[model samples]
Target: MAGEVVGHAAEAAAHGVDLIPVVALLGAAVIGVPLFKRIGLGSVLGYLAAGLLLGPSGIGLINDPESVLTTAELGVVMFLFIIGLEMEPSRLWALRKQIFGLGVLQVAVCGLLLTGMGVLLGFAPAVAFIFGMGFVLTSTAIVMQILGERGELSSESGQRIVSILLLEDLAIVPLLAVVAFLAPSSGDEVGLTARLIGIALPIGAVSLLIFLGQRIMNPFFAVLASSKLREVMTAAALLVVLGAALLFQAVGLSMAMGAFLAGVLLSTSTFRHQLEADVEPFRGILLGLFFLAVGMSLNLTTVAGSWQIIALSVVTYMAVKAAAIYAIARALKASHAEALERAVLMGQGGEFAFVLYTTAASAGIIDGPTNAVFTATVIVSMVLTPFLLIGMRRLMPKPEQSMDGIETVAELHERILVIGFGRFGQIATQTLLGQGHRLSIIDNDTDMIRAAAQFGFKVYYGDGTRLDILRAAGAANVDLVLICVNDKAAATTIAHLFRDEFPLVKVMARAFDRVHAIELIKAGVDYQLREMFESALMFGAQAIRELGATEDEVEQTIEGVRDRDAQRFKLQLMDDLSAVDAARSLLLKNAAEQAREGGVDIEEEAVEEEVAKSTQPVPPA
Candidate 1:
């Protein structure tokens, strides 16, 4: 009995020990993320800091960071998968020039420059080449996260950056092959057949993944979805991602690339949205943990022993890489500002350096100590990246709008201040212009302002979201502020700001949709109109007229719609938002029933179509 109790106690203690790391990691993230985000340094830096605290160098809570890093890498795989979902095959094909032309030029140039730098620092040609190539691969996680935060991932420039990153990811496979070729031979050499097999394996794995994905993924998802078990669907999504990732890793391709390819294959699948939603939560958590693991992996002892070497390598490599990137960007016809931005964003050596260095060390290409030092240098460089970006933002001049033919916001004594000069704003201004009411109009788009000037309308260059710009536009003196910006968030912010600070200034805003209109009302705007609402209503009324409805009947039907819409809006304002869902379902059910009575099988034909259409902005009412 005593021996059994001791064994049980020991097992229980082992279980408790296992839970410690999980608790520590979560606690660190919880404490770290919010604090760092609050100060604007970003959550990435926060996770790094927390990881440093929990790491062996700090308090030694988690000694083997490699174990955690291994798991955390899945986060990166999922992140790539999500990115692939956003990139449809057609859109990706559209970016082929940027991906191949620009991406190739940047990587080749940067790799050459960095390799030369490494050799100049007294390393052998092969070793230096390995080091340089590793650094050339930028951290996709860090860059993507920053771009996502800035909401630039969908921007034209952002897509160009993404294209370059994709090329870097592809470069990893060839790079590994190069590493193997460079490794010191141990008498038994790889024959031509072995080399051929080596090449064939990856090709076979990739072909198989494509075949299965194209032929089976959708149908498999369809079957799982029919089970109506949400958890099972989520599990299936994970299984697909991990299975693809493992297959790629086995074939010496990066797991992230494999997951990305799988995502692209499923991009057009009917279940794309569901897969994305299922993976998002896991991606976010694990991605954060990945950063944390990186921080924990930073060996303070290694850095302290070789601080000068690590520091010199970090500075020299980053500077050389940045210079190469800037020069290449300019050569590619990018503007000075864009060149500088791209250089700063991609300057740091990335996570893949560890993988490359470790592999090289195992193959006797570099010593273990050299690997440790280089790894530390990469981590330090990664840590400094956010700071460099923040400093660059502060020092770099904002792209100045040319005031050659455009006026700046100044003390204009107009009674009405128009925040945006877009199509909606231009049309709204026309009514006031016809009445001879002089109005001050401002827009941030230089091209738009210039074009408006061509049309004999003077649009000033200023961002309405800035309080100072608003004041300079005579917003304080204006009796009313007309906010017609197409951006929903910015419009809402402006409306809320005016309602709080310039309370007496009647504000009229343009909304993107019904939800935006409701938000504007809550922001205390005097009036708000969905940009598409009136035009759509007029279009529908015209359609009814074309169907031979009398003018009186058409007018009555329009009035009914208008009244019903007002009632729904009022109910939404009172916070009973569920009414919208209830009303929509009831209407769809009634229509389906009527169709059934009319001898149509609604479920067999129109249910899917109607369900899809119902998700669009609820009809005016």
Candidate 2:
């Protein structure tokens, strides 16, 4: 009976272990994600917090986190992949001087400086070097995320930091390769030259494979994509990621780097957007899991033992890094406020630090106690980042004069209306303004509104889509409604709301594209301009020059296509069904016939087959 009881107990324990991860993940998403979002903090922090709470140190839901960590590692790889995809090769090359020159200098200077300090603190030279390498890489994930949230991603300072971070990411490969070669498991007598060669050989092989694969992969994907099988396309995407990762591992390089390169190659493909949409859901879920695993890996026991050292290290590292970044920004000619903001945002150690430190420790280059201290310090620094950004914002110098110039009550007309403010919107707004229209423009972006206000234009901050704000903006008496918001969703919502609430008012909207115009038309939008119409006309004029067509002939052809598109547009608007299908069929048929007439022997049937497989009914619009 005792034996029987022991077996049953063992089985129960096994089952409990299996259920822990599921419970931890579910609980974290349920409790943490919403809480973080509600507080206007990013979900990343919530994931990290959830991981820490349910990890071995907290609720002990995850005792052995290795599997989860591996999965999470894939998330990082995918993250980099997507980032690389967004950046074209030309753009990357344009920034090459900064990425390589400034980036290399920053890493070398920071690493050496930090290493020297580590050695002075009594660490061996090897250990100090390892630590320096780990410290040199700032968190690309955190910095990019923060920049994106604040809309500074396109700003000068943000771009510089992004370039630096990209270089650091690249630098990690070499650093890890060196650590791997120097690992105690390897023979002590192995020469540096041979070790370097060992690393180089694998990298070369991987590069060759990627080059060759691209030639084949693109066409293969093109064929599959032409088939229009969602399942097949999704499978192909997964294959690209998993295959590239596995290939990298086989070549002895990091999988993340391989995934990044693969994404770079795919960025050149015409179907990049479609692939992005298909892969986004998978990427998001996997990334969340990856972050959760990172949380689970936090060793509370180690942190507890070296809290003082960890605290001091974090403070010192952040201070030094921030100062270094600030100096770099000034040298790079950034404004003082911009430099300060950049410094604060990039002061923390990042996800790459965790990877580097762990790899170094595993290679026996760093002692266990030192690794624990540094790891904990990195985590602490990350925790402080959000607060640091908040403080930076508060410290920004306030302008002496308010930009709002609503000096007189008469200036605030009861029937306040806004016209276009974008390149598209500006023309319409200017035309109306020249006619002495009493309009108060509404724009969501604070910076844009400020700029316009500086030029003595009256503008207000509000999302035009929101009915409450519109009502507050005097929708009752507003004689005209201008729905010039760039975002399609916002434009649509505003039009619908305006029509329902104030049917008597005229509503003019800017369409995002041809499809957008059709949608607006269906929704009873008064006047709609295709966003690309003007640009297309300009292009047509340029094409006429190259094609040797007379001005009249060129204009006639342009008018023909426009009329056809407009008639199709109207038909689509009226029927409110299968516009995209009719458009694609018409366009593809024309192109196929042209190719065949040119003796190119184009596959019209194949093209149609692919289109039939690939094209989906555009949602509503």
Candidate 3:
């Protein structure tokens, strides 16, 4: 009877304990995320703060962190997988020189320099090597996220940092293998040759899997996609991830490496976009959880105790790494601004550092106290990255400019005016120019105009919607107004302004759909093109061919569907406009009725009403 009572108490305690952490996590996100956003910092910081607050060192709510750590590992794997999908083989090959050459140089130089410092500071050789490796791998996630947010991901500096990060990730693989071999459990005296062979096997297996698995998986996915079962496809995607992960584990390789290979394989597949759409939410949630786990794992008690040492280490690590990266970037012939940005961006220790340090500690490559110090340093470096980036931005030199013989708009005469210079407008401009038209395009995006100028294209940097700017572009005498802007409301506004201000000009506009085409037609557009209608027809035809339908039958069916939808769309467009007009008329009638009830004679005011209606420009014919 006493034993049964004890068991019941234990069960209740377990249930109560589980609820506390869940509530705390939720509460933190609810309160902290908004607060962080309000303060102009990102939500990632909020999540981290939430984790820290609820962790054992803070509020003491979350006790068992191991489960969260496992999930966080999965998050890292998924993150790498998505990154692999984004990096196509051809693109990877393009960066091969930088990745292998600059990347290898950075890692070797930084690792040796840091290791030498660590050894001099009284660390064991093995411990120093592990520390060096940890410091060598920069935070790909944080750096990339920051660069992407700043819209600098395509900058030369960003590209170099990315290549270096990729190389670091690759380098960590062999480093881990060496650590494993050096561990007591792995038979330390098995010789360097045997250890090297062990490392080569796993790497070779992963390469083979990527080369062969991609060909087989693509067609398999295509078949599954034809079924049109979303749930099944999602299940299939999860299966691929799990299966690849299992294979990696079976071969004693990193699960992330396997998932990455799987992603690369699927990158070339036709269904890549669909797979990304399906897996994106899962990846995001898991990544957030991973970051939270990282926060929870932070031993704030240790940090508080050794504040001075931790602070010095963090500053030293970031300073040394930044200097190294900047020097290497300059050596590679990067511009001064680019070199500075790359150095600052890649100055922090990464998620991989956490993994490497922890694994090395477990393998006895590093002592416990040293491991703790490095871990604290990694966290502090990560926290300081945003501030470092801001400082770099302030310090970097501005680009030089030459003010020599630049032509003003007043000096140019043979100008072909383009109203909108979007994708369609650009095509139209190029096509016309091939036939000897001296075109001068107009667009709102300053970046687009600047880029166009680099390519020797004459583009006017101003909004075409304003009549003054239109006049400035010589709209009265210029050849054409190609209304290629994507926004419907903006397009309509510009069309009205053009018709009212410059009625003699010819106007060709792009329509959103068949209904939009009809609206454009009524708006007195000289020509209208339905953007995606033809593309949709072509897709249907392609589907029919895959489904074993005859070409003629497929063509006829597509044509029939197109004609029917176009007609239906036209009717609907007319009906919608008529309904809107009727509603407006009813509103006016009701107001007039109310006015009459108040003894106002609206019928006698017919002349005033006619004048008001006349002054209001007629709706497009």
Q: Which of the numbered candidates is closest to the native, going by highest TM-score? A: 1
TM-score of 3: 0.66
How are the candidates ranked when ordered by TM-score, highest leading? Answer: 1, 3, 2
**lDDT of every predicted structure (CA atoms):** 0.89, 0.75, 0.74
Residue 618 Cα positional deviation in candidate 1, in Å, after optimal superposition: 44
Off-target runs (Cα >4 Å) in candidate 1 are 1-12, 15-17, 402-440, 443-621
- Weakest 10 consecutive residues, lDDT, candidate 3? 403-412
Across residues 259-306, which tens digit of lDDT does each residue of candidate 1 receive?
999999999999999999999999999999999999999999999999
Q: Check candidate 3 and list the clashing pairs.
A: none
TM-score of each model, paired residue for residue: 0.72, 0.65, 0.66
Top of the candidates by lDDT: 1
Candidate 3 wrongly placed segments (more than 4 Å): 1-19, 34-38, 148-157, 181-200, 394-447, 450-457, 460-621
